[model samples]
Target chain A: MFGEYSLSELASIFAMQGFSGLILFSVFVLMALGLAIIYGQMGVINMAHGEFMILGAYVTYLVSRAFGELPHALFNVYFPVAMVAAFLVAGALGAFVEWALIRRLYRRPLDTLLATWGLSLILQQLYRTIFGAREVGVTMPEWMMGSLKLSDTIEVPINGILVMGIAVAISIAVGVMMHRSSWGRQVRAVVQNRTMAGAVGIDTERTDRLTFAVGCGIAGVAGSAFTMIGSTGPSSGQLYIVDTFLVVVFGGAASLLGTIASAFTISQAQSILEFFLSGSMAKVLTLLTVVGILMLRPQGLFALKLRK
Target chain B: MLKIANLRSGYGASEVLHGLDLELAPGEIVAVMGRNGMGKSTLMKTLMGIIPAMGGEMSVAQTPLNGLKSHKRVAAGVAYVPQGRMIFSALTVQENIETGLTVTGRREAPQDLYSMFPVLWEMRGRRGGNLSGGQQQQLAIARALASDPKTLLLDEPTEGIQPSIIKDMARTLKQLRDARGLSILVSEQVLSFALDVADRIVVIDNGRFVHEAQRADVDAAAVERFLSV
Candidate 1:
């Protein structure tokens, strides 16, 4: 196969594949950011994060179905409306989970991990029971369906770029909220030191609920965006959870820079490996690499300097 | 400015503060001197609403504070600089200070607070965890001051700190008490520090306020009987 291709042809093939890797990396970052907030910031391992994404995807699916029943002129403008609805639906469910369960498990990291895992199972079952076990395909509008060509043979999917843009935008917005807003301060206070935060009059419970919800809501948005690249189903979140967790843990908990760096590194590694090895082998190699890194940097790439 | 009457509180099944009665008049520095596990910290927690008051009435600035959450108490003008100075290890000194502003909804940090602790202002960008124990304690006190509470609670402020920093903290507290007329309720194991700074002293052992006296009246013998083995 290599003998038939010139150097320029190989370079172009790698470049095109790398562009696709960047898009996948963007999605992985979005999915992990939410997990980072809930699990890394609050130490609440939200195993149900993927389910929250699925919820968002399903909301987008419903919106699309509703738009399909409308006139062609009306359907075009309804895209923004569907996006908003999907975000709200996911956020609301995230808030509900926080209020009902997350609030009760403060300072219980292992328990939270187990509890959220159970929540993920329940959510998957709920989705399957309601929407059936078959994958649900969300139809995109005519304008969002094709690819954009940059050169003689350089083509990029428009949906991939849109998803990547949304991811970057969401990441920036969440970063600002964490560092700049009053809510962010409270969340940081809670994450840094709960007892002190409480003494200073921060409603740690309320902050925990809001933070967890925000994290889940963002995951939902990622799921909604992902419908363009992958199938949407009750179990859609399961496909992303491993990659999402890998990115979050690899980056280091509670650090946005870590998440971004990890996503970029993992995406490029997986994409490049996919070119040379089988998909399963590429994934295995990525996992082994992450595990090795963790073994060395137990505090992660960016450690939260906790006083003994 | 702050009053607690028959306030009862506990951790799980063990009652730490039982029917405690305490008061801090505006502009006054009141210290609670007791040994470890004597409910001094618990009384402070109950007043700040960190621990739920099990029974009896509690009031801050004459308003009922029972059933109100900790943050509500903060909004109602109560701030606590807890024992061990629980500063956010990952956050910078400036960010740690900003945590106090969350309760105020202010668009900017109060510049007056920086003037009070110039050291914190100098090291504003330094991580809280990187600071020395003395610096962290200063950051904790400064954070409470940022909230600009009517009543300030300091639990073991001078504990595990250098003597020079302790003197600095005492002076700062005196200035804050005089300039702002901020009522203070400090819990301390160091009786000498309390004797020098406090206007009145309250003594507790096990789970109750066993004695209350003016600072001038609290003799070394009396404090020794309460705090020492």
Candidate 2:
């Protein structure tokens, strides 16, 4: 494939495709962060996680429409407000679901998987009934429109840059919470030993609920950021669910840095290959490579060093 | 203060503890001596609320502990160290101690805890798993005391430790009681350890206390008869 192109042409192709890969990486990180907490930390497989993301997207869609009717000066700030709303709504729903559904299924991974799969179906139909089946796009402010000219070979969209910024900020925030904060220590303690954590006066049950809620809330933020690059639809979350799981599982659980690393690797491989191969073919090849490696190392790229 | 009357608890369908009654005054050390599977651990776990009380009433200073969650029990000034030393192995020594302060909604391990177990102070930055069994035991006690609990429950504190460390631990227990005025309920198969530390000794068999005596009045041969296999 490289035989037909000049060196400069190949360089530009790589640079442009790499930028697109960064955008995909942002979305993957956002989607997978929540999974890392739920599946990684809590050992609960939240199959409806993608639906939570879509819930955030729908919330953003509504917020954008509402902002459209408001004063023109307010439009520039609507995205932030929508992101916050998405986090709260999704987190609240997650807490409720933990109480209603997931709590009963703890330590039963297969049950949580099946239960959450059913939950995903219910959420999809709920979204379909309320928002209709048709996909909808958010109205972007003029300031978020246009592209940044970075040399002659690259002109990146401003929204893509904004989404990347949001992803980075959230990643940093999560890392800080998991490492530096006292509550984070309790979360880690519970994840390590539930009975011991309770023995030490840490409310293990409440910790589990908050951790689940926070994970779902992160997914909502992911969905909100996702609106910049993709349209909102009831089934759109389903499109990314498999890919998000791939990023998370391949990255390994209980390690935030691992998720981000795997997302970057997978996104870059797919985007660059998609430029040369068909999109589906690119996806197939990337997945094949990951599967082959995973077969040899079932623990993924980073295994947690927890006590046995 | 700690009291239990007609306590019944067990694992699943087989009831291990059958109507056991016990009490401990403030700053007192009570050792429940028994053979393996004699309900010593069950009594401790039930007291801490780790296992449900099938039929019983337990109180710490007259505050009932039944139906309260384990964390709440800890918040109400009860701390537990289970058999095999159930330390949070992945956490640093300091973090493990800090976990005890969780009920108080505080994060810092008290300075006195460092002085109480200076080995733990030296190993504060190391993971609990990295410590020797004796050090981990000390860390476990530190974690328990970090909450400044009114009562402590320890299961097999001498299990899987060298005899020298066990002696040191007995000394530690006595010092802890005199310093903090804490009530301690320890289950042990090691009679010597019990004789060294406990103010009172009870021989438990089949989930009930069969023989009881003050530390000063305890007949070693009689207690040994109940403990022998």
Candidate 3:
């Protein structure tokens, strides 16, 4: 595949594609982090998880548009404010959904999948009615626009680096919160044994609601970061849903480290393969490989051995 | 500290607890002995609000507990160590204990719980799943105590536990009753273990208390009559 290209050209192509893979990995990690928390902890298959991300993207777009009429100085800080807004708005809606719908369907996982898929269709249509069917793009802050020249042929986009950094920071924060915090202990307890957790005084229902909201909130943040890389539309989130689910399931559902590792592997393989083959073919091959591996080892890369 | 009157509950259409009445005073240990499929667990779960009462009046420390949720029941001073221990197996011993504290709005487990269950302290870093059955039972009890509950509900604590630790468990219950003045309602299949630890014994059959006796008056043959199939 590389015979037609010079040695330096091949090196540069590999470097650029690797960087692209990192960006893809960042998006996958962000999306899968939320899915893993919701599906992994609470056993809810949220098909509308993609809609939640799109909601975040829409929130970011609205925040940028609102800031357009304000002072130029405020434009530089709008992104951070938008990220927070995205998280809060998406999280609040998530809590509402949990209370109104997910709570009733918890004992029925397949029903939740169907219901949330229906919810996704509704949300997508709602977005179209509200924000219009046209694709929207956010104007990036000046600081996020340029690329850094690592060598003569190798240049890394500043926005890609920022997204990767955000993914790393958020992953660590979530890891610490889930493992070290007192609330995390309660969440784990509820996950392990709901009746016992309640018997010991933990508010199991409230924990479920909060966990679902946090997962959606993180998805919102991912959507906000996504605008730096791609355009936002009513169904833009659906584009990544399949890939994100692949990342999460290809990892052990409940393992955070596994999510990151699987995301990296999937993204890198797709990116490198895309360089030699068409994009769709690369994706098909990568997914086929994952499906084959999963067939052999159904538990994925990291399975937690829990008592029945 | 705990009372249930005319309580009725069951799984769906089949009722398990049929108009049961029970009471526990402060610093008292009441052992509920029953055969398999009787209402021993049902009564405990009903009191803890894990199983909703079909018809009943329940209270802890004079507060109405009828409509309260399970956590609210715990907040109203009830804690449960369910059958099978039900510890968070993937969590470390410390984390499992910490859950009790977090639920009750406490920042940490009581300092003395560690000394009381020395094995839990020794294996604080180990996962709950890795502990022996006896150790897991101890951990469950320790977790219940972490909430500083006024009433403790234990269902079959010694079912799979070793004999040596059963003695320790009895001693611990006696100490909790005598020293801390904690009210306890325990369900047990073993007559000897119950006799050793209980201040009062109640025999349940077909979801109703068929016999009751003070600790000194408990007849082994009478209790056995209720326990046998």
lDDT of 2 at B140: 89
Model 1 lDDT vs. the true structure? 0.86
Question: Whose DockQ is higher: candidate 1's or candidate 3's?
Answer: 3
- Quick one: ranking by DockQ, best first? 3, 2, 1
TM-score of each: 0.93, 0.97, 0.98
After the best TM-score superposition of candidate 2, give how far the Cα of residue A136 lies from its true spot, in angstroms.
0.6
Residue B64, candidate 1: how far off, in angstroms? Answer: 2.5
Clashing pairs in 1: none
Point out where model 3 deviates above 4 Å.
A306-308
Q: Tens-digit lDDT track for model 3 on B129-219?
A: 9888899999999999998889999999999999999999999999888878999999999999999999999988999889999999988
Ten residues in sequence with the least summed lDDT for candidate 2 chain B: B101-110
- Name the best candidate (by TM-score): 3
**Order of candidates by lDDT, top first?**
3, 2, 1
- Candidate 2 regions with alpha-carbon error over 4 angstroms: none
| Model 3 Cα lDDT, one tens digit per residue, A57-156 | 9999999999988999999889999999999999999999999999999899999999999999999999999999999999987998999999999999
DockQ each candidate and list the results: 0.62, 0.69, 0.74
The residue pairs that clash in candidate 3, if any, are: none
